[model samples]
Target: MKPPVLLTRDKFRESVFARDNHLCVLCGAPADDAHHIIERRLFQAPQEKGGYFVDNGASVCEPCHLRCEQTVVSCEEVRDACGIKRIVLPEHLYADQPYTKWGDPILANGQRIRGELFFDESVQKVLKQGKVLDLYTDLIRFPRTYHLPWSPGMNDDDKMMQSLAAFEGEEVVITTKWDGRNTTIYPDGRLHARSPDGRPHHSQAMVKSEAARFSFDIPPGWRVCGEDLYAKHSIAYDNLPSFFLGFQIWNERNECLSWDDTLEWFELLEINPVDVIWRGTFDEKTIRALPLPNPEGWEGYVLRLARSFSYGDYPRAVGKYVRADHNKLGVVHNWRTAKVTPNQLAEKS
Candidate 1:
């Protein structure tokens, strides 16, 4: 089938804004720009039309537009907000089928899809060729945690609100959200900072070296996800239980272990789990009224379902509340080459 005739750039922007009633789909502010869910470069013939389909565009304010560029607002989210059912692509682009690259669907914005989207074809090919490591390593990386309903700066939406309403009666576990690097450790002893590059953060070596002190037989694709609090980011901790504090565990099947199982494994593996701030049925007021850190060390809290859930359910299963000014300070200070300030541990009695 032939693709629709391409509209000029200005027409595309005008049509999208008009369709959205000149309102930002993210925040309800006056629209200032048109956003493309999928990059133009990913299209078969980007230069010709720049993939400017109205369905692929969203009207957003400048703040939301910047968030989209930074990928804080995911493409799938924009599509859901704008009521775009499916990305319309030219017929030529269809030959690629489900995914443009292994582990990447053509519909996804880069690799930051809100849910589990596709399997890695490259990993499957390698596994078929007897490369077991490829399957294990690629399967166990940390998944991104979404913001809670009350988290500052989030765009209000029905899905998240629905998730919040459903969460009201369920037992939930809340833990202190430490300010540090998100690191993952494999049973094979490989450590990685939260990055696509599969390399540890420069400030993470001290934490990784400390983790090397313990050993365990974690099943092939199970991963220990944690925070590396060795180097100061925005918050400086004078007394920390450990450099690497285990938070979540993901198995080969991409299931997040129950809180009980995670705690049990942390104890069995001699790992320090993050402090449990509260554990009970969900309460919106209590969570909201919780006092902020007095001296500015504490970042915030994370709430998760007490039971196990699949990786794809992360958006509904877990949510985080970071301090209002945390992102601002985090951006001003570059942790990559920032001075490493060792957090002092409490003296053993």
Candidate 2:
């Protein structure tokens, strides 16, 4: 199946391309190619009651895919660095066989990333290595972001850094951002997750075991990627299903919905999802003027599109404004509170 698209050669790539609006999953890269999901994957259509495998069957390109295989720090080190309390997977995602190779991950920039695609004892052992974790805080400094280890070890700061707009200060309304690695749990009762780089994130064995507990039929036509909040992202530790956050929701066509519609869907699921700030109409300056009311973090905002603006490829589409007072790096942590700024004070008055 040699198609013009980057990952179109593989059927799985076809699935993902059909799913991701042809955009790269990592760094929100526009879809360029197919990334092998080296671990748990199935050649057959997914069924709700049956089990699947770990993400051992998919494929990736280079560099970015490698991040999932291991972090800048080792797994154990990352685990320890983030101070995670537990890891949970019911075990239906994988068959008795192991997955190895994980292959190279596809990047936003057309670069190839590598990961643990092959499921071997060596891979298992490699993944088992120590990760230095810091469970108490999420506000890590730049370069400091990778110091801990695994993606799960990331705290509120890490959470804010990736999902929200830039942080401006204490007035930011920081809510308990949900914790779940970016994933798209399919509505067909299938669970397809991904790493940050647009590579496949399968843990099918866990999906089968964990899925049964939920009352809602995992939506058959939708895939929502958000942090699966467990002990890692919580002040207290727990891996309960109810705790997962449903962030970006995509249709089967890989078309994204408006932020408002997303919120409504979560409501349908009976789950409360956190989001970037929602304010009445304001210009870029006004949005910049408002206090960054987050519990604490900012990757930049996943700005919700108003219904007027919501349409094809709208949820993933965003336009945001930020404060000029940010530090030298333009990093959120470096950004200062606008309360001291003139616009904010004037607005309050």
Best by lDDT: 1
Q: Cα lDDT for residue 212, model 2?
A: 39
Candidate 2 lDDT by residue in tens digits, 1-349: 2212222235545554555556544445454544434333222112211112212112223443455454332222323322323321112222322222232233344333222222245554544542312111111100111111112233333311222222222122212333234444544444444533333322233433443344245454445555443322212223233435566565533345655677787776665466656544434445544455542333334343343221211212333332222222222231123121111111222
lDDT accuracy of residue 119 in candidate 1 = 34
State how far residue 320 of model 2 sits from its true place (Å). Answer: 7.6
Q: How far off is residue 112 in model 1, in Å?
A: 13
Q: lDDT of candidate 1?
A: 0.67
Q: 42 in model 1: Cα distance from truth in Å?
A: 19
lDDT of each: 0.67, 0.35
Number of the predicted model whose TM-score against the real structure is largest: 1
lDDT of candidate 1 over 28-115, digit per residue (tens):
9999998876554344333334767787789999888767654456566888899887665432232333332122332322332122
* Cα displacement (Å) at residue 17, model 2: 31
| lDDT of the structure predicted as candidate 2 | 0.35
Q: Which stretches of candidate 2 lie over 4 Å from their true place?
A: 1-180, 195-219, 231-242, 295-301, 308-316, 319-349
